[model samples]
Target: MQSVVPSPEGLAWAQRLVRLDTVSEHSNLELIETIADHLRTLGVPLRLTRDESGRKANLFATLGAPRPGGVILSGHTDTVPWDGQVWSEDPLSGSVHDGRLWGRGSADMKGFIGLVVARTRAWLEADLPLPLHYAFSYDEEVGCFGVRHLIADLKDAGIAPAACIVGEPTQMLPALAHKGVHRWRCCVKGRAAHSSLAPRAVNAIEAAARLVTVVADMGERWRREGPFQHGFDVPHSTAAVGVIAGGIADNIVPADCRFNYEFRELPGSDAQAMQAEVRAAAAALEPAMQAVDPATGFAFEPICSIPAFSADADEPAVRLARRLAGGGETTLVAFGTEAGLFQRAGISTVVCGPGSIAQAHQADEYVTLEQLARCEAFLDGLRRPAAAC
Candidate 1:
């Protein structure tokens, strides 16, 4: 089969997709419906599946005959928030300048999604020997929720891909591994009292401060004593508190305090064990706080768990990705992505797409026209049948 090059129409489609503001928190139902309709017209078999909330959705489309070993092109439809950044152009306008497409999700994701959709037309036109599956997910910027359902559906149907290429921006290089992210919220409960008589009441804020100190101490210990074999810039797990809230007034002892923390762990590290350490520290603090007043307590709730993915350098999928990416050496990234989840589902996965991670989650995120063109060529190569070994 002959691989088809990206058409002008495909570029136009990508531009239109960039115009839709599907920020992770915003509803992506319209975008999902539009893509589903477009795939149906392109002779791709598409099924629209929704999570329990229906605020977001997943679209699974396939080309060529269904088979055991196929290729899955995956991308997230949601983007990070662009709430407080100064932009040279309208963030959602998909403006083009200097041969680059600029928009909210131009780099973080929608660019890759557009490329995959554009290539779908070529796959549909050719008589490919292997099937090509496209999985578009929502809320990836928040957590890996949308694809979890899609993966479960595929597993339920006993359909597993031979390989999955997650179109996360890698500047056209192949990424074989990335760190995992674990997010949690901790709450400290205490009794409130007048500042003048604070000794009689337990202060939630004070308890939370101790908890934060424990987290910082643990982070430092991990940096000093933890394994550091990974190639990540940090080279070890990192923990930090991102948000905190407590207190009513300077005069009153706070009754409740809450904060969210995250851990970016290296591949193969025990993320759960790290979380356990934090929990234990919080628990130990609780007894002290409760001794001041029997009402003090602590609780921890998980927000998200993103697993890490690392493929062996000699793996067939990595080799295929290198070839498709024009023979660049495989590398690792510190950010989290859905590639790990796909790999855990028994699909050899690699991360290779257009643009650079530097531009992701920025105000005027953009993807160079050159990178887009390279991605188009990569997809075209995949459409062609393999030569005899």
Candidate 2:
């Protein structure tokens, strides 16, 4: 396909958003409020669904008449931190160079958000057959927390969109399926003692290491076994421990150890079953631990969960997205997105947007002007009423 010049207003909006730092650890209210203020100027009615702290929020707005069966264009406001990444220029510069707009969220999602907002004027002026809704969420880079509140609020208000398009760096291609994300933290409690007397005292790090071995075994089993789904980069489900912390000194037996682990499972895989296996392994270890001390055992805490998503091939939303994206074959992704949550809420959904996932969360993250132009064309196509939608 030939490259097209991206909309000047859209590029400006993308740059404006990329300039703002809405890293996952920080509150995204500044970015949310910025977009809210712009929407207010367009006379669009919107609601702010704020988290309990009131520092972060999700913005849900309608561009046409207030009614059900609207089409939702969704994007997350928060981004992963660029702390350790080495970049030649400022990560938040939002600079336009080499036919690309560069910044922290230029590819991860803010590019799609900005372009969507830039098209508000045209969407507002057109006699749209159906409403166009904007659902900008926060904390997606962490675990897709903000969209839950937004969806609940929509339920309370009885606002149901006919379909949803999650702009999650799919390179302008519509995605039909993706893996689920489930994370947990395990804490082992033992009795501290001198390293020389470790035989009498329970060793937390050692016990935790045993459990970690079990986790690793389970992952290896899955890797070597069946239950694979084609199309995903890792067709089989995967498990891995990410963070671990324990002993302060090698001369002492540490009483506490904690580790975080996650499972990325296929759509039909039972994540709970996988978790149960780990819990059972922990239980088997508890007897040996309790023999040493009554207080010794394992505690599991859930960290985050995002369900797997698989859209029906004949669904109106899938058809609409593929058509808007210029009739490309639908694909599957290994990454998790809010698409599953939206689908669970009974809204036909697909993941489709500008940019490449490879550039997301990387140094000098960027979205090519050509990709943005293609996204703009896709959105323009969406503006025209179609029965498929």
Candidate 3:
């Protein structure tokens, strides 16, 4: 069968969006303005709300009536850092090569967002039966932060959606489930002393090392005996310390040390319980350190926490997604997305979009022309009237 193609205008919009540099650290104001301006030109009504820091913002727009329920097409506006990756092209400069678009956010998200926004315009032009809502958020790369406020606004306004589609690069398949993530930074403080009298000093790095070991052991136990029934490839919640820093030299007892740990919790896993186990282990180590120096202590602070989401394979949203994507079987993923937060807010949500997760957050990230074409067709199907029973 000959395949359908995306609208030329929509493709242009996607390329333009990919060109913007909205890395997680930088403000997404430029992207927001671009979206808002595009919506205005398309005659779609929009509202822009800035976070308190004024560093980021969220854009919400709707077509058709503000009814009790509608479909929300959502995507995050931030991209991960590309600081050290060796890329064939500039990560910020969206370049097209071999029928693929390469850039930082092209696959991880902006590609999906572009398709949705472009389709929204097509929907407006086509006068679809159901309302389509557009929701673009910032800081999703940092843990789904921007969408929280947008969800709150929707709730306060008594707005509800029949279903939500979070386009998080699912290779254009219907993703029914994904794991949650909890990130933390643990800091240990101890007394420093001369190398000649190391026994008199409480080494922060040493304390951090003990904590890391405890976390590793906990991960092993979880893998062996904890809840591991999920269908994911790993089939269990996993934990790891990604980064650690301490000590200036081998001779000196380090006064302060910090490490970042992350937990990928399987669906239904109690994230707090896992974190408590790690905290208890750190606490147990504190007294020994304080024995050498009374001021010694440890602290754990949240970096970010993104909850898990799963939709029943039989759910209407999943069924619709499968149908729209031409009947691929539903699947689960191990990575987290903003879909969980949407589900937590009582919205029936599913993850289905263009591009592959494997290509996300990598050097020369790109989405194939085939994925983009499939996604445009999916959106076109959504705009079609539901068939009568």
Candidate 4:
């Protein structure tokens, strides 16, 4: 089969996708349906999974007839919100300028999705011995949320691919391991009272501040304590509080406050244990608040849990990814992706894709045409029998 490069044609396809504005907050059905219809026309086997309301959808299409072993090319259809970003061109322009595809989803993933779509015809015509599965998902920007159900569906259907390649921006390099991302929301309930009666009032903001301090302290400990993995840029499990909210007047003691925090743990480390530690610290603070009033306490809500992913360099998925993408030392990335969920589902998985993560989810986000060209070559490589590994 001739090479199918991700060029102006592929960029055009990506622009059409970016134009849809499938931000995680909005429904991704539009993007998924369009892709599903295209795949249907190619005579591919399709599985469409949706949320209870049918607002979001995950399209799992098989280019060739399903069989025991094969490779899965996976990407998320949703992009991060760009409500406040300033750009020289329309964010959805998919404009080709200075050798780059300028668009919101170009770097993060839609670029790879476009490349895969561009080569769907080639893949269908070739029909390599090993099957190929395109697992494009939704709400990946929020968390590895939709892919969880998608993987469950695949399991229930007994459609187990031998390996999966998640198209998360990695400059077309193969990422062998990445940290797990765990996020949670904590609420502090306290007694409101006039500022003059400080002794009687249980300050939720103050209590929440203490809890955030605990999170910071734990983060510091991880930085100093050993369990360090050298490959990761941070080289340690990390934690941070991203959002906090509460109260009205400064004169009144805040009755309630909530904060969101997350921990990105190194592979083989216990993020759950660290989360428990934060909860325990919050519990200790509650006793003081409860002393003012029995109703004063703290509550916790889980946002998401994405396990860390690590594959031995010699793993079949990693080997095939390196070979297809051109050999280089496999690296670990700090960001999270659905690859972790895929790995947890018993499918060997690797992270390999176009563009640079630095360009993702920010103003002027774009994927260089050079990178897309490399990705196209990788997709073309899959058409060969050697990609069966």
> TM per model?
0.95, 0.98, 0.96, 0.97
RMSD of each: 2.6, 1.1, 1.7, 1.8
Error of 1 at 144 (Å): 0.8
lDDT by residue for model 4 (1-389), tens: 64434666676777778778888988998888888888888788899999887899899988777688799999999899888788888887877778788889988899999888878888788968699898999888888788888999999999989999998989888999999999999988888899999899999999999989999998899899958999899999999999999999989989989999999999999998998898888777777777779898889999988899999888889989999988776778989999889988889999999999999989999988888888988888998887874
Worst 10 residues of 3 by lDDT: 380-389
Please provide, for model 3 over 150-175, each residue's C-alpha lDDT reduced to its tens digit, 9 standing for 90 to 100: 99988887778777888888888899
For all candidates, what are the clash counts? 0, 0, 0, 0
Model 3 pairs whose backbones collide: none
Residue 335 lDDT, candidate 4, scale 0-100: 95
* Best-first order by TM-score: 2, 4, 3, 1
In angstroms, give how far residue 186 of model 4 lies from its true place: 0.7
Candidate 3 error regions (>4 Å): 387-389
Please give the ranking of all candidate structures by lDDT, highest first, separated by commas.
Answer: 2, 4, 3, 1
What lDDT score goes with residue 85 in model 2?
Answer: 85
Q: How much lDDT does candidate 4 score? A: 0.88
Candidate 3 lDDT score relative to the true structure: 0.85
lDDT for position 385 in model 3:
73
Q: By summed lDDT, which 10 consecutive residues of candidate 4 come out lowest?
A: 1-10
- The local distance difference test score of each candidate is 0.84, 0.92, 0.85, 0.88
Better of 1 and 2 by TM-score: 2
| lDDT per residue as tens, model 1, 237-326 | 888999999999999999999999898888888889988988888777777677888778889999999998888886756777788877
lDDT of 4 at 376: 86
Leading candidate by lDDT: 2
